[model samples]
Target: MPKPLFGMAVAFGLLLVILLTAMGSFALFDRLDPPPLDKLSDLSVEVIDRDGALLRAYTNKAGQWRLGIDLDQIDPEFIEILLTYEDKRFSSHGGIDARAILRASWQLLSNGRIISGASTISMQLARLLEPRQKRTFKAKFWQMLRALQLEARMSKREILTAYLTLAPYGGNLEGIRAASLAYFAKEPKELSLGEAALLVALPQSPEARRPDIAPRRALAARNKVLERMATAGIMPQSEVMRATSKPLAAVRHAMPQLAAHASDRLTRENPGALVLETNLDRALQEKMEAVLRDASSKLAADLSVALILADGKSGEILAEVGSPDYLSVARAGWIDMTRRQRSPGSALKPFIYGLAFEEGLIREQTRITDSPVDFGGYQPKNFDMGYQGDVTIRDALLMSLNVPAVALLDAVGPARLMERLKRANVSVTMPEGSDVGLAIGLGGLGITLRDLTQLYTGFVNGGYVKTLRDSPAEASALAQATSNMGAPILDRDAIWHITNILKDAAPPQGAAKMAIAYKTGTSYGYRDAWSVGFDGRYVIGVWVGKADNSAVPGITGRSAAAPILYDAFARSGLTLAPFAKPPLGVQEQDFADLPPTLKQFKLAGLWASPSPVPEEAPRISYPPDGARIELSRTALGRQMPLIVKLQNGRPPFRWLGNGRVFAANGRRRSISWTPDGQGQSTLTVIDAAGRADSVSVFLQMPPSAP
Candidate 1:
């Protein structure tokens, strides 16, 4: 009774089975035949140089290798290990492994989700070459089909070679060959079994297998690769055991002959130039690195350092260290601190003095009172808690006096100074106060190594400000907005004068003083130490501080950072040349007779003064022989006939005040003082030689009883 019905049901079931099979085939074919992708190894790297040497490379995009050697020189063991771990049958099979596919499919069906990957070496290469595509089953199938197609088109060895040379290992290292040289500092052909194992483990997870950094994890992965190689009969079992058991050899690191800074420039010029010629002086770079490491050790382990050495005239960065460990392969290590910004201590004073000289607030010979200057509630103390009633701007700069710089900042206008800094590409954030900007004037602002170095260029380059460029081409390409105002901040004569003072004021003995003009900077609480200077040839800057953003106890720029600069110059074997002649308008003065105010106040030997000698008081005015500073009183104090006087070391001196003049001998001079109780004061002076000098000190006194 149901034979016909049973037959119809059977036919229907068979038709359903046929339909399902056709659908499955369509899915498989779709997955295995996806569209081809464009090449993915797109990168542009920057390389920097000094004279004509290869320094280092930095990539603006991915797939850039910064190794100092050729890829072909890499060790063969690394390739073996990579193939053994990433694709065991790389030499025996096509790109797609049927066994692997079956196993993965079974696992996925049982788990109800894709739980494992069956990607062959070719497939992996395809993924790397076209990483922009989606990662779905369809995408994976297409990758497999493409890999198989590639296998048909190319030999197994050819595919493997491409994979080994094109894969990204880690930070800027794009191939196993480059990675081998970078991690071990040796040719790839020279890698040991243990070293090969480590490199092999990296392709699975570059960060995870960073033997130079995470040795324990790298060792474990390397052991696994060795075990696999042994199991596959690629190596003898005894050899595998020995390789797995032996301690990983310490990899030799490349002593990059190029300055790390040069890398930034090279990457911008050529996108795929793996081997770059740089301008770094290898000797100078090594010395700089040594000094930075040593200086940081004196502080906390977390302390960091950054530096840049440039040609003063050419603005070429001879050496640059962005951090203590620029090549650190660790997952967690010291960050590049040089490019980052932090507070600058006394290093910024030169710019202040330069501006003061330009404004005519104080001449090099004018008397500057080194007293405890009170700016509203803010009081600036000296390095030594002392004061000299009288000091010239040149002497103040030589000693790095805080009061005078603050005084000059108040007079020249902090806003103007900030404008100057901004023009130099340094972004400075001012603080709060009637003298808010004064604090920053003494380097209470945050600045980066690049910007700080550029700031000093003004003094070296005829007082004109400019921006920093990775190369001359980049500089020339800058838009008007990016370029600085080329106007002179200080007269060329003024800059020349200040440079001479700085040269004389250099620490009695230091590393860079032999061939450079420099200034040191220390942050509050000694958190950061910086030294920046220039000679006729180059400009250099260095900074040392804590990596964890904590203070480096007692490490001042003069103490810790300047030595690095000195060491670099010494190692580079560069000559220190005399700065060029200053443009005219710089006059000379004799620092002799003491002013009556200094004598009356008994400021000599006072602890609050920037005394010429530790125990002696400072004598001179705003600008010393070659220094410059702005001079103005804090507030409009009672109007008084302020006396201005100048005396040579030899003889007669004359005091000038209120348009009148008086005479004096070599020792000391006194002038009449008349107070009108107003807030303005002016003084004039003429030495026996008839050299005229004038100064105005604004004094704002406490209000009388209301």
Candidate 2:
């Protein structure tokens, strides 16, 4: 009854089954052997600072700097304009739009020439992922097939991100990020509407629309994109009109060059890493480098400078200006002097005095002669060549007189000083086969600014020391810092004393020294000048001089480096933090409160061997060299018996600063005198044989009225 209709139904079912089977086979083959994106995977390294600010970017193996980007990383309007201009049905189509393809085919046939591209963004991505040199029929077919495969395997957002990342915009400039940075000097996320339109239009014919070479063509292309957007109602009419009138960039900008040395070092340290993040503050780094460059003009063209700023509490290096001008051949700016070892002249005095205070060899009120003194063959003099006759230990240190500093070094012993520095994690290099000597107190040993600054950190950090680092902390860095820190260089009492003294160090004219405790040093023949200072927050070390070690006349830490240091702190905008509270037992005392031996540092018995016979060499026995004698005070607060005694030396002896003077007679070994005041005073005993001994004893007289 229905033979023809039944035959048609059976053939229809068979045809449906055949089409389904063909589709399943094609999908399976496409999944198994998809298009490869091997070429696009070779990305260049991106070096960033602590704040994720770009420092430098390198090119890929193909010598093109095509940074990867995501659709979300760009403005939504940019995506809208791109889709409306390139492919209207991009989101709905599998890969290619059939209607657009048919229209393109009709146009080509009617005009006998290629009219429009029926390629979606995914199709463009396919071509970028597996580029073909020629626009042939076979190439187009493969691109369409690859686009379909990509659409099936990846999400729309992933496909769009890849397209924005890999799209070629002309010679060695690929992707929105690269092109935006090149033309706008900014990131894709920060591009304006006009900037986005220009980028979207350029990829269609990158060479033809290159703004640097053909501004008119780029403008026309961008205007056409805006017109299309307006016609499609993608963006508001006002925005379209505004964007169309905006100008295109006529020149390309170079990429960022912040932290050049740090970035170069990071690449060398962590090769093969696609991205590196450091601990440096890019803004601070750039600012400090600018400061250094500005200061470079004042220095001789042949001289350079180096600076490092680090958080004292954490030892994180915030900024490091390796040289005044890294590219200046005349200044040898390529050398990172912060790591370069140079003499640290008077900069070492604080540590030497610190060691002396630790050993109870001297006190802040101890009276030390600044007159010229020689230790064996080594002789050190003051910077001005004029001694301050008699100066307090604090005065000696604050003034940076070389003689008194050497005297303290002689007392502590040079080897012990070096041992303390090593325990505090400072690398030291002495002359080959030479033993540690007094000259170390005057920059005798070779050391780098890094080591010197680290030592000072220990001195100022309440005896705590740690390794300074430029990049983020690593296990190795922490281990090195751990090995270097924690064991106090001196007791809190000693460290506090050193800090209190250095805090009062005078600054150069028109500089703020109270904000930081700093010291300056000039190497031999003024070859190197250094000013290292620290506040409650950061420790900054600066070195200025010729890299070749050629002496520069009149260059010194006080004049050249200190001024720069203060200026740098001012420019850094870092608030001067307060110093840590002084530890308990760090009592402030005047001269009369110091021990007898501490009153005047003795040099006679420093290296004296045990005496064979009882020789009359003049020895004071009552109040010993370091003896603390407390005299009773009467109601007046300034009355007591201060007895002075001596043993050994010729009979007749004379005591200066005492009303009674002995004549040529058998020495009255013991004598008694009334306290003149409650402060410290130097007591001198001279034997008839011309030998003498001096002791500074603190007499506990009554406190004066406030």
Listed in order, each prediction's TM-score against the native is 0.52, 0.78
Compared with the true structure, what per-residue lDDT tens digits does model 1 show for residues 299-376?
Answer: 334546687776655555556676665554330123556566788889888878888777655556667777765565
In order, how many clashes per candidate? Answer: 63, 8
> Candidate 2: minimum summed lDDT over ten consecutive residues — where?
632-641
lDDT of 2 by residue, 304-394 (tens): 8888887776667788877877788888877878878888888988888988999988889898876656566566766543356678999
What local lDDT does model 1 show for residue 626? Answer: 34
- Alpha carbon lDDT of each predicted model: 0.61, 0.76
Pairs of residues clashing in candidate 2 = 591-680, 592-679, 592-680, 592-698, 596-625, 597-625, 597-626, 651-667
Question: Where does candidate 1 stray beyond 4 Å?
Answer: 1-287, 298-300, 326-333, 432-436, 471-476, 479-485, 508-513, 585-587, 591-706
